[model samples]
Target chain A: MVASSTARTGAGGQTLVVDLAYPPDPGRAPFTRADLVVTGVDHSGTSYEVRLYLDNPGADIDTPRDPEAGYAGRYTVFGHGGCYGDEGHCEVPEAAGDPTDVRPVHQLTPLDTFVTVTDALRRVLDRDGRLSTVTMVPVSLTPRRSDRSPAPELLEFADLSLHTYLAATDLDVPTPG
Target chain B: MGVRRSAASLSVAELTDLRDAFTALYGISDDRGYAFLAGVHGLPLPQYCKHGSILFLPWHRAYLYFMERAMIDALRRSRDDPAAAVSLPWWDWSSAAAHADGGGLPPGWLAPADGGANALASGPMTLGDADLEQVRTNLPGAVTDGADPVTVRDPDTPDQLPKATTVNRALSATSFTEFSQIVEGIHNGVHGWVGGAMSAVPIAAYDPIFWSHHAMIDRLWYLWQLSPQGADPSAALLDTALPPWPMTVRQTLSVPNLGYDYAAQVVG
Candidate 1:
């Protein structure tokens, strides 16, 4: 990972903002590509969509999904609905359940989602040279119960990071060989 | 042994046999019934599934195997000889043809069956009072008052379906974990694109197309497993148990060992 940043959910779980910077040197950049890696994504609730915008501070659900608007890309989480099993069945054990237990981890365990935003990141970098904050707009598709005491949150993730990678160096060749 | 083919390539006879199997299974009305198998995915009691975990792919593979085997049993009960020949066909939603016509739903799944309801398009969502509450618990206002609440779909435009490039990139993944997440994201997008009951996980499996959709995902994993860049899952993951089904991750890795293999597309 070359250039990276991390962030949690924003106020009211409406949006998330994370700081992302461009590589220092473009001529001989260390990284060949970039990606937006979302880690520890909780899929135990209703499904929803998260639209990522590069640097548009005012980006919202109404924002146009295009490069001009800093709309990088979007991804959806197919939620597991909710736990209907017996008590503790859906709980992610802090440690292994039992020493001899062979059962897999809870189905609702947090997972990771990765999106290769190379083109989007490059477009922003080329224009501004150095890119900053990424704004995410979350929209829940599942209908919630109006009478429920507390509304269930649609967006839950541990961290949103920008990761860059290095490709194999180009082969050296003699001039006019 | 069974050979699963792309849903688009199934012959008229093959489609008929598959539909017949569904009808036969639907009629059983017992634990072996279609509804019972479908409910096992989500809703009612025992929502045996593994999503958002490393076991996501392998668990669903075992689930599909269980359902396919039950379909064979249903065909056998109806005295349909060579029942084993009929394996579940996958809806290739990420193919060139799928995205060509604005990304329409699979015609075989949507088309009406001979002289009546198409079991492929939709099937009876037999939910009891408790089960109905379970649906509303997650989905809120789904399954309103109705005598026959058959599964319904409100699919998005074909353009909304995942592009072939999206899936091709997932297939190119070097690690099983990376491959699963990419493919799973695509899977989630397709589920939401299908909307209606299909969009919600609790009642998703009740829709007949869910089986084929998962079959498509399972097929992708099978292809990835055989690819040069593909590597076997970690040792711990391979040995983990997918409950409600007796199989482990290792057992589900080999499609042929589970008695089925996806057929190579028959190009003209």
Candidate 2:
């Protein structure tokens, strides 16, 4: 992955880095998928998991316990962070035992995987001749409970990156002049 | 490019009036409420899927597009009705009046009402999770079952709640903070760079109006950025990425990808 710093603060402040990975060329058949990986080092060794989620029909990306089974529809895995006790379904079983799961941590997903999913979605949309936009969000993980209040400190490591792409067929149509 | 139109020319009272009038004309209730909404917006009938979910941002933009169209249509009908006194109004929640007390809840939008804790109830009243469930269980046919489809239930009457009451109650009470809070709360209240993966499903399954809510939230951020106490104006709160993801400020501002444009005045 190619990385560049876009936003920087003082020495003590955190810096926002932009990673530009190779795009999937429609001319080519399928290509190797790339993952957007963020690694965070705390007292413990680096710990992370790669996650991908569907952006449509917004719902919880992680499956819930029996009590929350009713709300399974609203799931999306856009960013990575510390593992929670109930995040059992989304958790990499080996990493769940770590107490640091509650602390700041990074979640990684190969970039190519995301593109592939998005590309498939685009093809479906293309077949239907529909114009739509999908937002691909990238977030960094830190050791923190998903339920805790949002703080600048916690936000220090998290960033929201958005990507916009058009299907090859979508490009051929004329946009309003 | 032509000069952008200003949303400032619109007023919240007018929007509320238009919404109410439309509700009255179409008979806003659970069974036909969504259809009325679709009709007013001039949308083709929705082709829904049992397992597919509404895509975020785009879906909402479509909703808002129809809403705007509905408002315009309402305005034209009112011109002929003469009896109708409604007009479109924009809710500028960012105004000082909205945040006078510092809490996020805007005044006058909803009033607290008492009901059994476990039942799903609806109307211009506040009900706990129980009432919410009741409303959910009885949603009209147009409403689809999804991962987090909003629900309502009333424990007291259990069987007697009107569909309209439940839907209106849900629409009025649901907000962005509530959705975000639920997600965070479910995850044990931790905050950090958990990434967009977590938000995807909720956002997708989220009502099409979710985009308008986010647009409103984005508008708040814009307004907050202008405040003296706001975070650094130069700070980039949104991550930048290349297509099929956009990375630059200019790219981020494009409406085609976002699905809708803020009334220029709202941005100001």
DockQ of each: 0.31, 0.05
For model 2 chain B, the run of ten residues with the poorest summed lDDT? B45-54
Per-candidate Cα lDDT values, in order, are 0.75, 0.27
Model 1 segments more than 4 A misplaced:
A2-13, A23-29, A83-93, A96-103, A143-152, A168-177, B80-84, B111-115, B140-144
Lowest summed lDDT across 10 adjacent residues in model 1 chain B is found at B136-145
Positional deviation of residue A139's Cα in model 1 after best superposition, in angstroms = 1.9
- Judge candidate 2 at residue B3 and give its lDDT: 20
Candidate 2, position A170, lDDT = 19
Q: Candidate 2: where is the Cα deviation over 4 Å?
A: A2-177, B1-16, B25-59, B71-102, B112-268
Per-prediction TM-score, chain B alone: 0.93, 0.35
Give lDDT tens digits, candidate 1, residues B160-183: 688777777788777899888878
lDDT of 2 by residue, B139-254 (tens): 22112244433321111111211122222222222233222222222221111122111122211212222223334534433333333433321234223222222233334334
